[model samples]
Target: MEVAYRIHLTAILSVTCFLLKQGLPFRGNDESSNSLNKGNFLELLDWYSLRNEEVWKTVNQNAPGNNQLTSPKIQKELANACAMEITRVIVDDIGDNYFSLMVDEARDASIKQQMRVVL
Candidate 1:
């Protein structure tokens, strides 16, 4: 049984290698292997951390576009899609009340693009 299994495996491998050697591109070479992986998922800046007050203030000052409690364009874009709201306490802001930010996760009206809002 084991001998038969090895024979079958060797046959498949030989066929594959033969096809690849014939320039069929069935096997991955060095460059092909390097380009196959898409890489890791990126951590977004908007929600990674609210840890430092300076960082929070910098984002608010530079991009007031993200300063509001919600993204109107986002809400409108998600007018027909399904979504949810996420709230988190941020110690990254320099102010009283320790005001927390409201973050919303919603998709475009067609459920294409998902967006977030923070206040």
Candidate 2:
């Protein structure tokens, strides 16, 4: 509930998402309950927090709550936010650049035509 704690949690969540996008494997759903104790990201964060005492006072103090960023709903929200952020960045980058898009039409086993776009 402290401002500092909120900021700390945000930073941790951001870093976790960044690593996740980079193809790193985080503990799956089954391990979410024990993430703080056994998860790699939290383990490393805990190790680093020891030296940076001012940034985070304690591991358990600002740790991710049960339904905070780890819950299924919250995870979907974060994924959507991340996707939108990526789309914005890509659109901005393409504004001044020339890019080619390809569209393909194919028939599926159900005899339905499907269109796919690649950029």
Candidate 3:
């Protein structure tokens, strides 16, 4: 059971990272099971499971409802965790070194003003 849980988590995390890397939105307008497109994250997971038996069993069938780790909150937490790890790596690589920071203001697809920071 423990191994199965780990596999399930790994599969979800892989999909989450892929979406994050692509700068894609995680949720769709309708995410019901019967919906044609159940959002990028869920749709990706389903697509992945079709090619991996262990992931398919662990995620789609065997995982407990409470611990499926597919909630919106879980997705946010996973992305946050990935971001923190990336920041840690960057910081470690620049340890004891001076680095220049750049900031820029921009608008996203929704025309929302945002700040971009680079280290």
Give the better candidate number (1 or 3) by lDDT: 3
**Which ranking of candidates, highest lDDT first?**
3, 2, 1
Error of 3 at 8 (Å): 0.3
Task: Give lDDT: candidate 2, residue 10.
Answer: 68
TM-score of 2: 0.52
Per-residue lDDT of model 1, residues 14-61, tens digit only? 433343345333222322223553111001122321443443444334
Tell me how far the alpha carbon of residue 48 in candidate 3 is from the true structure, in angstroms, after superposition.
0.5
What CA root-mean-square deviation does each model show from the true structure? 25.8, 7.4, 2.5
lDDT against the true structure, per candidate, is: 0.35, 0.61, 0.93
Cα displacement (angstroms), candidate 2, residue 34, comes to: 5.6
Clashes by residue pair, model 3: none
Give the alpha carbon lDDT tens digit for every residue of 16-53 in model 3.
99999988899888988899998999999999999999
**Which tens-of-lDDT digit does each residue in 19-116 have in candidate 2?**
56775544443444455454545454555566676545534455555523444455456666777887899899899889998999999999988888
Model 2 residue 49 CA deviation (Å) reads 3.6
**Collision pairs in model 2:** none
| Per-candidate clash tally | 1, 0, 0
The TM-score that candidate 1 achieves is 0.23
Candidate 3 shows a clash count of 0
If scored against the real structure, what TM-score would every candidate get?
A: 0.23, 0.52, 0.87
